[model samples]
Target: MRSRGTYYLVYPLVIFLLLVLLFPFFVMISTSLKPVKEVYANPPHWIPQTIHLTNFSDIWGKYPLGSYFKNSFIVAVGTTIINMLLCIPAAYAIARLRFVGKNFMMYLFLIVQMFSPLIVVISLFKVISRLGLLDNLLALILTNGVFTLAFAIWLLSGYFRGIPKEIEEAALIDGCSRFQTITRILLPIAMPGVVTTVIYTFISAWNEFMFALTFITSMEKRPLTLGLYNFIGRWAVQWQYLMAAAFLALIPVVILFMLIERELVQGLAGGAVKG
Candidate 1:
């Protein structure tokens, strides 16, 4: 009873932290709905006297937001797919296959993670220019895939290693080929890890701003992150419209979380353990 009573003391702190984290989102939504005049009014209002619903419609029609959204979706999906195809085989090989320099190869993947995209932006830009991929969504897709590959392999390999070898041996003894053993038996069990990887890759590619800004020259090729620039000029900032677009931009990510929220939690937990 005493231990249970002590737990009540932590509830207030948790609630306080939740409110603190949520406050900025609340402010953004509030600003998005406020009229331009009310935005800078003295003693800013948390709730607007008049909500401006036109912000959404205006921004949509005025800017190439739809194109930006399409480009982001294309790049994000492409990055996730390429990462999965490449990482799955590499992770499986590292976790299950025994060969010389296997440990060295694992170390190499970890080393790659230490290098951020920002560090090689100039070199990458030159390469993309040579490939004639500048201003193309393909450029973002390819670059994101390469940047995210190291983490995907490291994560998936850990999950792959956690599965019992006896299960694979049983499948093999039952006349299943190596491919069949992996596809039918191992994949279903390792789905949590896969989901985790998908979410990470998708989000990273979607939110990537530096490469998108640098590589994309055409207005229509820009992603949602770059689309926010439409509301800013050299002299003025359209705070309301900017916030409105930003709020709308968050919807897809929120829906994604809602859809796979369960699998993500399970994957993270399961991926933590080593076989």
Candidate 2:
């Protein structure tokens, strides 16, 4: 029932998405179900004849998946909370306050965020080692917070600026403390940006490879991403086990994106429009 031109434009993208995006998920699941022998078959089995459910058990027994998962949880959750706490107040201040060198400060933050992790890996490793914190959870948690803080501040600051000054002004007249004003008035209104920050921090920490690889030498302190890579390289690549773990690795991020779909969409859309 659609016009020809409209269908022509939409169909390509639809098919492209299906082939490029959906195909990998299909492959991941299919590979996960294959037996090790079938996985190595000369002609890859499109539909795996043998369903190898024990891949999960084999991986669990072989790797320290539980420890890796716990380390990731600690880093992701800790950094998210730190990002929210540090970003909200800092964003409120930057967006709402009139101060000397405001633009200069913003520029400083932008520079920090733009700086790549690779360039500073040696410096960061030295700091971690000097702090006597190498191979510890604190190092990971703090590293995540430091790395992601600028982005959180930058994003939430924009959202705070979008909020009208009148709301906080009224709260101030009513004798509300700065803390209370931030907590009660600004936070609810800037919920989308907060959601965005949380999503970014969680995803960044959960998937971070290079920092963990450099900072965490201990097996128990390693995050899932590094663990997964190590798991793959330990022997002949167990495609079935690797795929199963990859799917598991993806679950939290997928759930997070689904849950905050609306907020994330709005936040991203609003930022695009502003830009």
Candidate 3:
């Protein structure tokens, strides 16, 4: 009886929380479909009087949306690749090797996450300028990779630790090299964690605004976050167009989450337990 009563109480609270979470998305969709006049109506409304589908089509021509998406994709993919390349090796070492400062190194990575990017942006700006990487997509890729590396290493190492050592030893006894064992054996088992790290790194790189704003100067090189500025005028903001572009920007991330939802959940749960 208590369990039944608890379910009744919990259902409403869960529904309310879900509604709260989805309300912004609902607003974004509603505003995206609204005509300009409807957007500025005296009392804002939940639904549009007339659906304006042109906002979706118009955003393409009005702004360099394609270029922005391309730039974002390049930066995001580059960051994820670099992150994985560096993280996999480091994580393997931390998980498998009995090394000095192993625990300290793990904690250090967590410490790195505690600091905000704002603290280091100025120093990074000087370094980027000195390297002549300013206004370059490579600059964003590198910075994003560096910032996200700590968490990736920490998570991947935890996932690696969770796996049985006997498996790797058996492969080693069978004459498989360390590298081969990592590539052919351990990686497949740890794929959920890898996918989680990839998705996290990709999203971080995609949504990054501060570093992009600080580093990128060329209009053509700007990512989606910066491209959104085109909708903001001196006096008036293009609410409909902005919302449309924002909604479109969300599609890739939403699709990625949908496809990898199972792996991501397992990765997170596994990492938490193992870490």
Candidate 4:
């Protein structure tokens, strides 16, 4: 009876919080469908009087949105690939190998996350400039990979540590080398955590605005986040088109979550306990 009463109390609160969180999404959808005149209507409304699907079509015709998406995709994918390549081996070493300063190295990685990119952007810019990588997609890929590496290693190492060492031992007993054991045995079992890390790295690279803005100068190389500026004018903002573009930008991320939500949830739960 007490549990039932608590459930009733909590359910309403949870519903209210969900509604609050989803309200902005509702507004974005409503605004995207509103006509130009309706967008600036005297009193803003939750529903569009007339849905304008052309806003979606118009953005592609008017802006270089396709290029923006391509650039964003390249950078995001590149960042995720490089991050995983570096993190997997580093995480394995930290989790399984006994070495001097192992704990200290793990703590150092944690400390690196404490510093924001803003503090290092100028220094990074100078380094990129020196390497002639400014205004290049490779620059974004490298910088994004570097910034996300610490967290990825830290999270993955903790997840690796949580797995049973006996499983690895059995693989080794079958004449599988250490690298083979990691690839064939551990990676498959730790897939949820790997998926979670990949998703986080992809999203971070996709949504990154600061590094893109600083490193990229070519209009053709702009990412989706930077391309949103095209909607803002000197006098008035294009709300309908902006919302439409914003909505379109969200589709890939939404699809990613939909496909891997189960793994993401499990990874989060596991990380919370193990990490």
Candidate 5:
């Protein structure tokens, strides 16, 4: 009887939490579909009487949204690729090899994760200016890759260590070279961690604003965050168009999560247990 009562109480709490979390998304969609006049309607209409679907078209035609999306995609994918190339090898070595300062290297990576890019942005700006990469997508790619690498190394190292060493030894004894063993054996086993790392790094790169805003100067090179600036002016803001563009921007991330929902869950759970 008491357990049943507790379940009844818990249900309302869970429902309330879900509503709280979802309320902003509902508002964004509602505002996006509302005509400009209906957006600030007196008494605040939760639902618009007349839907305006042209906001999407207006934002796309009025702004360089396509270029912004392309820049963001290029930076995110480039950053993920570079991070994987660097972190995976380092993670494998950390997990399998017995080099001096191995423990120190692990500690250093962990410590590096504690620092935010904001702290070093000025120094980075100077170096990027010197390299003539100040307004380039490569600048964002390099910076994002550097920051995301520590997390990848830490996460992949834990996952790699969780794999049974005997499997690698068996493959080696059967005439497989060390590189072959890593490529053919370990990488397949550690795929979940790889997916998690890639998704996380990609998302981080995608949503990056400070570095993108600071390093990128050309209008054509701006990412989605900067692209949204078109909807705001010194005098007034275009709320409807901004909301529509924001909603559209969410599609890629939502699709990524939906497709890899299962792997993401399992990878996080496995990392928790393994670590």
Candidate 6:
């Protein structure tokens, strides 16, 4: 049996977590379904007079949604592919390889993240302009890829370091090449880390708003974040449509999170415990 003090301590934390996190999601769903009338009712309505399934249909049909989805998918998927391809090997190298300046290089990458995004805007814009990558999907892809690559390498490096070297040594003795050692041996063992890196890169690319807003100039090239701006007209706002758009925009990310939730948990715990 739990002690009274332990129960008292844990119960309130549980309540706090649920209220802070789950409550907003509940409100989001409620707002997504509720009509504007009930959504903004004087007292506020937790549940609507009538549930609206058509919101999803409406946004998809009404907005330039296909283009938004395409743009987001391109960036998200491209970033995921690049981060995993580079970071997995980079992580393995940092974790297992002995070389000059390895720690220094890792430190540099972490330091880059410490600065605010605003700091890099001028240089990145100049470079992007010179390369003619501004307002391009590939630009978003490359931006997200480069931005998240450092963290992926760092996180996966930690997870990789936590794994025993005996596994790779065994595979090496079995005549595996360095690449083979990574692909056939280390990767299977560190699948959790790779999965974590993939989800993190994908979600970061997907949810990225500021860079997307700035880099993407065309209406057709806009991701969901920019696409959402269309619903809020200058003079009058379409509250219902905005809510619907927000809900729809949230769906893919929610699904992605659900699929990799286990890895996310493992990744979070790994970082918290070791980092």
Give the number of the best model, judged by lDDT: 3
Instruction: Report the C-alpha lDDT of model 4 over 1-275, residue by residue, as the tens digit.
Output: 57888999998999999999999888899999999999999988789988899999998977889999999999999999999999999999998999999989977998896678999999999999999999999999999999999988877887788899898998899899999999999999999778878987898899999999899998899999988875574367888888999999998888876766665455446545433
Q: Which of the two, 1 or 5, has more TM-score?
A: 5
Worst 10 residues of 3 by lDDT: 266-275
Backbone clashes, candidate 1:
0
Cα lDDT tens digits for candidate 6, 39-104: 668998778779987776777777788788888888899989977888887888899999999979
Candidate 2 has a TM-score of 0.89
Report the alpha-carbon TM-score of model 4 versus the true structure. 0.88
Q: Which stretches of candidate 1 lie over 4 Å from their true place?
A: 1-16, 254-275
Candidate 5 ranges with C-alpha deviation above 4 Å? 255-275
Q: State model 3's lDDT.
A: 0.90
Pairs that clash in candidate 2 = none
**Predicted candidate 1 versus true structure: per-residue lDDT over 57-83, tens digit per residue:** 887887788888888999999999999
Q: Per-residue lDDT of 175-251 in model 5, one digit per residue for the tens?
A: 99999999999999989878878887888788888998899888899988777764574367878888888898888
- Which pairs clash in model 4? none
For 120-147, candidate 2 gives per-residue lDDT tens digits of 8888889999999998878878888888
Colliding pairs, model 1: none
Better of 2 and 6 by TM-score: 2
Compared with the true structure, all predictions reach lDDT values of 0.86, 0.85, 0.90, 0.88, 0.86, 0.81
Clash totals for all models, in order?
Answer: 0, 0, 0, 0, 0, 0
Root-mean-square deviation of Cα positions for candidate 3 versus the true structure, in angstroms:
2.8
Question: Roughly what TM-score does model 6 have, to 2 decimal places?
Answer: 0.85
Worst 10 residues of 4 by lDDT: 266-275
Error of 3 at 69 (Å): 0.8
* Candidate 3, superposed: residue stretches over 4 Å from native: 1-12, 255-275
Error of 4 at 167 (Å): 2.8
